[model samples]
Target: MAETAKPAPAPEASAGPVSAAGAYLAAGVASSEADYAAAVEWYGRALSGDPANPALLQGALMAHVGTGDMVGAAKLAQAFQAAGGKSQIATVVLIAGDAKRQDYAAILKEQAAGGSAGAVLDDLVKAWAKLGLGRMSEATEAFDKMAKTKGLEAFGLYHKALALASAGDYEGAENILSGKAGGSFPLTRRGLIATVEILSQLERNPEAVALIDRNFQPGTDLEIDDLRRRLDAGEPLPFTIVRNAGDGIGEVFYSMANAVKGDADASFTLLHARAAAYLRPDNTEAILLVAGLLEQQRQHVLATAAYATVSPSDPNFHAAEIGRANATFAAGHPEAALEILQALARTHGDILAVQLALADGMRREKRYDEAFKAYDAAIKMVPNPGPGHWVLFYSRGVVSDALRHYDAAEADFRRAMALNPNQPELLNYLGYSLVDQGRKLDEALGLIKRAVLMQPDSGAILDSLGWAYYRLERYRDAVLPMEQASQRMPVDATVTDHLGDVYWAVGRKREAEYQWRRALSYDPDEKLAARLRLKLAKGLDAVLAAEGAAPLKPVAAAAAQP
Candidate 1:
């Protein structure tokens, strides 16, 4: 991604002030392209010329933070603030650095002076910092103040529970999580873990068991199953979610990061994630969250680097590897993804998540036989898999069909539908395949109708239903859905071609010619193009005769014969 040297700046530019704006523009381009290192370098070049440029200074800070350089980010933040930049990024970076050294007074000072860090985050961090400073009453007040924020009942109450637990007040933590104190809130996975630890601390195993049973579906998640067994056996679950005040503060940032995920751009969220990582280097959950945000922004290299920090011994290591491999694959490095999966398959063979990711990557890379084997291995790990596993069968079915194992593919597709009868994708794939083979026309039409009802807005599913009707010689019925699918998926050659055939069947010769020409413009595969060309010149009946196929039979003709 390195750029070659360009021509020098204008003599007027050299005689006047340096073009920091131009350097910032280049940095922005690199950051958007996922080249954080290049962005950092360019932003630094900008800063050297215009040291007080708030926009350029914060831009460099973000690049440094995005690359996980807390030290460098802190230094840049100091320079930015001294230059009167008024940066929330700088405030958060400085606050994180202070928190890392356990300097609670710095956090309080920043808050007392009216924070440059975001208002919500400033208050939350202050509460956790108070806990670290051994001022329990003040910490409680800050948490209560946060709880009073409109529509933030869950976040505030959740943090207050963590504050209690970290101080060995497990009974108080239990009150909040169990809804006996602080109004009700939906328990997230991390919240559930905290509650489990709290209940175990109070030796209330039965309540913890009930909580697990209420939250998770029967035989759904392995983590839930293990937690249930340990609680049943009267084993105490450790409070690992927030082990200290520092970790609690990190959790505060992580919670806000999740809350703002959809509403904010990636750069803003990346700042909070970076702070969390700084406080707890061993926080695998936080680390993975950071990597995921980077991936969303297309910063795949930085994401992969972040993912690599989770060691093999960590419980979240497989999850990290899966994410890293996906990032590597997405960065036009499929071989890297394949290499990691191959190693992981040998090392973590029993883990279904790892196996599934490996299988999916192989399937994407067109290693069909290897994908089938990996998918089967992943399936076997689950005895009597449930509706959640329809994806495994569905994916395997696709590879099976591609490999021309049609019978096996059909069986897989049927099993997937049986497992999840309402899944529109399963309905569409199976129905479309049957229709394409010119068999079970009635059943195919019914399945496709059900699928269309479930996912009326899905262009692919709509196309499948339309194709089913067309193959049934229900030309009139096909037209509406075919046209709708074409409208939604305008660039799809298959949908365009299908519409052309439906038009031809209805005797709209000019419209049929128009659609075929349109499909050709969109670039159908060579074989489909050749067939389309024959139809354009000789008509459907003549083309069928040349290919040793019977002429199309409309539904009425078949019904009359019966």
Candidate 2:
């Protein structure tokens, strides 16, 4: 499910320039949503002018299959074939169609002739075909054959065992776990759970309990909880561990892939996960692992497809949707992501984590009202709110401030501060808000100073401190800190403008003009930009009059000395 790049649209010959751009834009949007029909229509419009464009051809192939238009896909494949346009995607689609038709022999013949299929997939599909033919012995042998491939033997051995157990050869499966099998597949939590079940099926309840305790003594999940209950009840559990060797290796790769974070090479990790998933079609863990890696690499579209494989019935469905939503947001499709989260909120109403996630997504998109509602719902749902609830209040406070709901914003900030006393961000934000409103100058200065002491390296906190001084009419005293703040946040127009004001108040007229110019170059808000322009045109006194703020006062001689 690694996200593929969206193919560029073909140049439109039939349509006017603006219409062509519109078609291209529409295709881009459709592809992002996986609305293949709409994407096809848009691409077709573009292709009317550039029929021979390879990018359009590639997009058409993807759109056709994504929409389940197999006939259309086949036609595209035929066209590509005639045009000598070879691609892995085209080949895979053809193989997939053959797979649907149960034409295994033909697939095998083609694979042998082509000699270019994904190695793991080639083995797995062949083994599955052997299963379809009711040739259990051959299927088992096929798995063994796959096991012989370098770096893939564990997968083969694992799937072979699952195939054995699934075929009702429980004793044989247990024997494989007992080390009768030549290869060793690394056991995972899931694998161990399956192994315990297999042991129970062999009437080895004691061994099953022992295995569960040995592997999962310190943690619990739904699977482990169920196993514990069965063990207590002395029930014979089924051997549900993968009997297929390919699946075992898939599990191994999937586990490794998930653990690959924070400095691991994403491409290498993806290769393992992809190989494992290819070897085992039903390996949701592997698919998710691939998606997670792709997301870490900022490959959003690929991550989305990988996450899409987790069906609603899967235990990890919520996790997958969360990943999918994050990828969609990362891909700059905030609306689609919000829609997904809204749907999830309805279905997973009782899940506090899901509600929080939805709220967080809304906050990221600056939908303050919607985010506040979600946060309220989350707060109500948590019967005994924990320390983590501070984040909700803090986030809500930010959104409230953005909406100019000062009273509510202050209340939320105070609430968060009470829960997590001396929190740097809360202090800085609340203090900055006060400073911006030109209210409670002394208290705001004190709060910002405290925040600065806690996080001196923070440019935002330093800016607040500088602005507070400027508000207090201590222009000379504001100069150094404001300059430091500007250096730390050199690109921030507000910081630069604050520095300019401090300069003008100290009678450094030329320096003030230079800073004002720099502030304009920083591209601040329209109001700030206008103020800076006025300051450059006349002086800080004129700008202050325009802003209705008190005029700058000269500092005492002792302060001016600095």
Candidate 3:
């Protein structure tokens, strides 16, 4: 059976009326749960009403394209063109389909007509078509022409190096990286990795190691670690970067495509990113970008495959791993995600972020003790933990409490509070703990009151305040706060139970019983469940007698002289 998809926020409602056009627009903005079927329906409706509307035609074409209904996309594109509408999107779709169909001559003809698809793209496609037609010298000349263009030199140079390497010219690729060429591009991790591979292929292991060490140090990520190992082992790596003008233009489009992904048309974004990856098979970043776009469209399996393309030796491997883990978890395979994280942790032990990933994975698996150890490791790895690090302490506190190590849990909470004194969660958690222990009631109440002041709308903090009041026997005062807490956390079992207890303390028996039933339905804890059972079996009086707690009294009446 297929795994269920994770919940995502509902899509923003479409603007305007509920007409066919409006429905189509709404479908465009709908969550992935609505599926392409919904999009097709809406598009059909819009097209039926306004068959020649360019926007509606484009929308329908895209819906079909997304669903891999190529026949439909082609038919719509033909119809759209016959209606005197020149859609850049439709043209690109047609070009891509043509390429897949090996209609190279037609693709070249379209390119010759100056298809205003992409400036850099048109030139690159023309160059590749030349290469495809067995014109090597023309391809080389075309690549050189692109290399001379302003602001496009680096891209051209990189592709030139790849082309040289692919043609068994390792020395040429190395010369480019070594600045034997007139110009130089800043060596990003990807560029450096490719350079190192070229050097290694040329049997220059020392040069490769120098490049790796200079660009990627020991303390960063698993990919660097793996590269370091390969260098140490003196392994000969293969050169894999763009080798032609087509690939260079693809990189340019891919880079800009990533930045504009969610803000622009998905089909267009996918086109640019896919074109980049197609032109440069080893462009991991482009692949990842394509995967991200696919993820946004809810194509989980395809996204996962794209993410997996980032090899262990790529600098972006960690990023890919994270994406893969998230996809796996979203696809309802938490165990698979944990496995991936554990493997990453083993290889990337020195990186704090990797350890944090491990801790998150373990926590999701409910292995609290192991997760605590991972968190501890992560905390120790950081020289001076930031305010964000406080969450680690707070999370560990939860794990500690779950493990019945309340004293340790309190210490972690206090540490987190020290780091972020005004953090309402920490304040409420620690304050609630003290109240539950039935010790330091006054101090707990003060802390909880402060927490409530800090987060007036937080149901948990408000519940803590009410519970503290109930513990202090300020029963009448507890009623208002408890009711407010119940309003905020209407579905929370513990808060509902607390509200019921406060109601009973204030002599509202029927209301208290009603709340108790509500609490039970919400699945309260064993202790709360027992209290609710007792209240049903006997009364609040019997529960108080059994627990050996003092009778309700006003705060002033219960106070003692210091």
Candidate 4:
């Protein structure tokens, strides 16, 4: 899910030279807001006034890198180092610059001189540098050393397999990737793709197909499906996971970014992802990773720019466009975002993910008719609908309900339940709808109880369960769950209103009126608001009598029933 952009933190005014202080403060504010273009501008101004300031140099370098200007960042890095400054980011940028130039010796010299870019990254870069220098034995030895280190075995083994495949030692790479040479380790999407390519080189297309099938499902992942289709056609895939030493170094940075993503600061991960893209601009995976991290940080404009860099011909182009739509939406341009998805749906309509994304966007925008059509197109693309396709049915059901096609909505919801019987959201939605219509009271209560069992902490599900009991006239049974639901969702207008209704049925008239006031303060729909006001003025019984509805049974009377 894309985060809505938040206000940028205010930068403290620096107590420095007056001109430099203003520039520094402006740059800091821009950077905090992820306005890298403005940050680069302000930091450049700050650097011009304070040429030798280490902090200014570092900030400028980061801003340039964030904009994907590796050439500019390299120049600032050199100036930073010339000023007696030391930084891990500088080391990473310099190493990437050297790799781009194919100057492996410089990278080795930097490492030998104790230029560190994190322990794991430095070690991986050293191994790749050795490979670039044609010192195969040293490279293998360095990779072995990394594998022997605790907590880094997976990365080391995975890269060693890639290096072996790049060197045309397919059998050796297969041994490592197949877990015959080393213990089992998880493979990332890139790692798995590399393995499939290696298998194809060895004329093991069947095994590659099986590998793809085992890891991915049909109509789910377009990239995986494309690879599988080509492999099944007996196409010989060339090993290109790492085309050269530069790509190997890029992979090292990309791997580190993947490793530290959720554990490290977003900016820290961005540094690694940027370095990866700088080293290998053709690496769509790295570009997507950079865009995703920026989106996570609510830098929607920057993320959209990053996503735009993925070429349309790339297999992951659909994925990039989806991400771009999300960033665009989060940037507060819903119309533009919807257009992007609409265009993607036209071009890649056969791809399941694209259609689903378009449908979801339509649903979010409350275009129920268009959403229903998009969902139908997506569902038709599935070869045989299975349990994993429950979301498609459920989403279409939601649109159906919104469009007042209750029969179609019920059918779709039942279809979703048949596909995924225990899905709590589907259960709660269907059960609550049944209760609201005063139909299937017993079955509605049972379905809601099941949903509550699965998601005890979900305020919506609890509300549904309580509402089911209240509709069945079990007022006392409804009280505890409704109160619990209100507590869980303290400010939800509907839950508070339901709690008020339950309280009134149980003869807690004063508390009932208080809860109705709270619900009104929470801003319910106009229809519910008018009803709540009537109940407040004339009391629950008077309002029910005016509407010719059955009055709430007393708690004692409800409990006295069988």
Candidate 5:
């Protein structure tokens, strides 16, 4: 046998001032938990006593930036750099500060001193700084050089197009944006909008309108619709995608944030996104990115605050409100979330997303009647429902089921299945519902079997399959799946209860009682817990007899093997 290892000794308690060691420890704990605000406060207290401690300064600096407190971070950056700290993040903060003041010479000086925000970003910033200094030829040359760099053609060409448009070279901008200069490059929503504006500036409003139509469906995006309407009316839209080099610099950070979103650490991505938003307050996309990242970090209050920053008159206001509602809900303010959606519905009822969100909020609150009506209103918005609309029907079916409108619920479920035949949740729900009601046993079994084949690891679906077998009096057939489901969802009250029932049906009386106790420990609902206690006290036979339920049919001894 292998020798057992002894536990490591814990650190001895510190005798230093609380502001020195204790504050530093607290900051580190908060930072590790991503509680940046608390970390910043603790770091401040620690730094008060230790001032130039490199680790304390670095921790404080990162905590400030993590909360998008650039002003505080800049001050910490100064202290950090003064004490010989060399951090890339400090360099970025100083660079952003210079960029904010439109001090192009300062930015160039920083770059000359070997300060960099990585290779690609450094090159992009150099080009934008050149443009800021009015060195048009130098900026264009730098952009062209970046375009020729293999695998980075899109970044250079896209920015070059924006620069040309800002300089009133509509033809040159159009050539690059329309992919006539070299080869086609991918365009983001902002890039597409820039191209549309450039086309309109060149007196090609018809082409701009057609481009908008090709990229965005009518009635889908309010901003796109507004653009299309203006273009159709023969309006010459101004090229405001990048009005100056400052906005261009902001775009660089925004682009970096988007690129690193899923691949990098969320805090790292948030730095870029927050920097972008700081440099250009009007960059709604950057703000949204910050809010979304905060939500992912479970900083729900911060996310809600960021979402609330979007102006009501802005085209993205609806999107922001929706995000705010979700963040509010996540922050344990479900009623506030419902209120936000309800207001959104009053203002933008024609929008499918708004209606769907409102319906979902009602459904979550168990306001089934209101939820069903809201879903009805949402379904009416889709003239011709397709596969993407499957969720709408599914949600309506769920609400209908809750309201005891079984026939309507079944019809809606069928419609949802027709739209997306292989959706495992839909299969499981319909099958489980049928099995629970003791109807359509064979069809229910087939549906659940198909669902299990698709999602074998789903504890809920496995539980449904096991319960179906129990209902069919196949005690032996029910055992394996019930045991597997119980293992997968060890703390699930319903699954534990089902496992207990299966055990009792198979004559494992002691195991049945053990599972029932476990189910009670997992906090089953009052009714479920009551029944479980009754079964444990009086046994399954008398309990089933009292409830007038069918008694378990005896199985063959060989078939009863656990």
Candidate 6:
């Protein structure tokens, strides 16, 4: 919503105006989809004809920054201002360039001139800009001022701690992080790792080891485990989380980027992410964050490139590779995704995330046996699994059901329910399966009813509930929920098909045929489509009779009542 994620592309009226119209609209759609490179390309094409179009210039600049091309953004910034455009993003990019060159005066001048991205951004960057000028007291006071503002205290205090640590004031940083300096700070991976490195700096290796153990479970990451082992063995850990004011500034952008991620437009999010990566090129976490934001934008190629920058020896390398695999998968290269995950499973077999990724890839490809085996491997990694592992059971249940091992599927679903008793998906799946088999009518109804209560807005769950009622011969009860489900999921072939069957059972013959035709139009799978055609040709009851089945009225209804 912020800044429309990208400028509206020009309309393509009258065949193609190429600029100020057609190409501009093309740029808008591309940028909106997070195809920044494509947006840039189209914007460039449009700008050649309408040189002073503020929207096109702004869109091009955003796309440039999204790809971490600060130089291109800076060049566009000049053109934007000359074109009488006031773009906050252009100003930020230029300010970032100044920060990169250690030109604090230039950055401060822009802030003084009322050119800023926003209040929090301006203050934090100004704080770091003061540090670039070697004015430690002024920088601390600036951070303190931001801390006094409502809702900004946490971010301010966290940055202040980073600045203090970078300025060789470990005691001040420790006081803030340990909550002795007032309010408690939110925990993050970077923040926790910073505390560990700081504790190590003070020669409190035992405390650091204890802190890591207390905050994180065993084997949280290979790097953390390595750090703990070294700490216990009395190795002196270096204070390298933030070595300079620029790195602290990078942390500022990275933190805010994470905070406003989904709420803000992807283009706006990339602005801060770009600054984080630019200010501290070696910060692996920031780099990974950049790739993640790009992945959300669906800029898969760029995400893959950003993720590939993290070295394998880095603690966050597996995290980066996982992101890369996902990006590859999203880019319509599931085979490439599978290859990365399969390699990761071999290299980091003990890591549950790697095993899960392999399993997920297999599941997506419909290679059920491989996915099941991978899930088994993943389940073994957790000696005593808890609620967090419920998804593993649920996913394996899906595979089991596809293979027609109903007993195994039911057991997995029930085990998942034990772990997460109120999980809607588990309830719906188990309930629908029981309903389909015409067994445990009361139990199935109870589970699905609870599921509907939890996720009343879910189209799929509503359809399941309706199908359960239909199986129980409560034709009248099935109609309303099925209608709602079809409306909610208008394109879902299965829901439409179920609606058709219910309509037929209730003697709405024309409505049933229309619903069946609508379902077919949605392109169902081959088997379902064939069965639907048979229903249309012979009618539901006649088709049942041909298969030596009981008529829809007495036998099927009686069998469902236990």
Number of the top TM-score candidate: 5
Give me the candidate number with maximum lDDT. Answer: 4
The alpha-carbon RMSD values of the candidates against the true structure, listed in the order shown, are: 4.9, 7.6, 8.1, 3.6, 4.7, 4.0
Local accuracy by lDDT, each model: 0.83, 0.72, 0.73, 0.89, 0.87, 0.84
Task: For candidate 1, give the lDDT.
Answer: 0.83
Question: Tens digits of per-residue lDDT for model 6 on 323-394?
Answer: 999999988899999999888888887788888888988999999999999998888887787997899999
2 or 3, greater by lDDT: 3
- Which lDDT tens digits does candidate 2 get at residues 1-562? 2456554443443255646567767777766655565678887786677766666676777666554454576567656656667665555555555554556665566567663335665666677656655777888888888778788776676666667777778787767665677656676666676678778888888888887777773222434756777887999976544544434434444545555544566544555466456555566777777787767755577679878877886655777788899999998899999898889888876666688889899889888898888888877875664566787788878888888999998898888888886788889899999888888888998899999999999888888888888877777678888888988988888888888878888888898899899989877879888777777778878867876877766666426532
lDDT of 3 by residue, 1-562 (tens): 2455543322233344467646656556532453554566677766887788777777777666555455687678767766766767676656655554556677687666544566665665566556656675776677678879998776567656666676678897778767788477776566777788788888888878787777765656566577668877988776555544344445455654665678887767876676566556567777787777777777776577778877886766777887888778876788888888888888867777778888888887889989999988988887786677798888888778778788998999988987888888888888998898887888898889888888899888888888887887777678788888899888888888888888877778799889889988887778879888888777787788887977665345634312
**Higher-scoring candidate on TM-score, 2 or 6:** 6
**Candidate 5, TM-score vs. the true structure?**
0.93
Q: Over the stretch 7-118, how does candidate 4's per-residue lDDT look in tens digits?
A: 4323333354446777788888888877777788888877887899999999889988888898899999889989988899999999999999999999999888778898
Measured against the true structure, the TM-scores of the candidates, in listed sequence, are 0.86, 0.62, 0.62, 0.89, 0.93, 0.88
Candidate 1 Cα misplacement greater than 4 A, ranges: 1-19, 29-35, 145-153, 203-210, 217-236, 504-526, 529-543, 552-562
> What's model 2's lDDT at 294?
65
Clashes of 6: 5
Candidate 1 C-alpha lDDT tens digits along 1-562: 2454442333233454446677777777776665677778778777788878777878888779988999998888878877777668888888888888888888888767655677778878888988899999999988887788898778788999999898899998888888898778888777887898788888988999998888887444656677889999999888878887888888887787777876898788888988988888887767988999988877788899999999887766778898999999988899999999889888887788888999999999999999999999988987887888998899999889889888999999988988888998888888888888888988988998899899899888889888887776677778889999999998788998889888877778789888888888887889999988988999877888898976777545633432
In candidate 1, which residue pairs get closer than 3 Å at backbone N, Cα or C atoms, i.e. clash? none
Candidate 6's C-alpha runs over 4 A off are 1-22, 49-56, 79-86, 109-114, 149-151, 221-223, 554-562
Q: Please give the TM-score that candidate 4 achieves against the real structure.
A: 0.89
- Residue 426 of model 3 has an lDDT of 83
Span of ten consecutive residues with least summed lDDT in model 3: 6-15
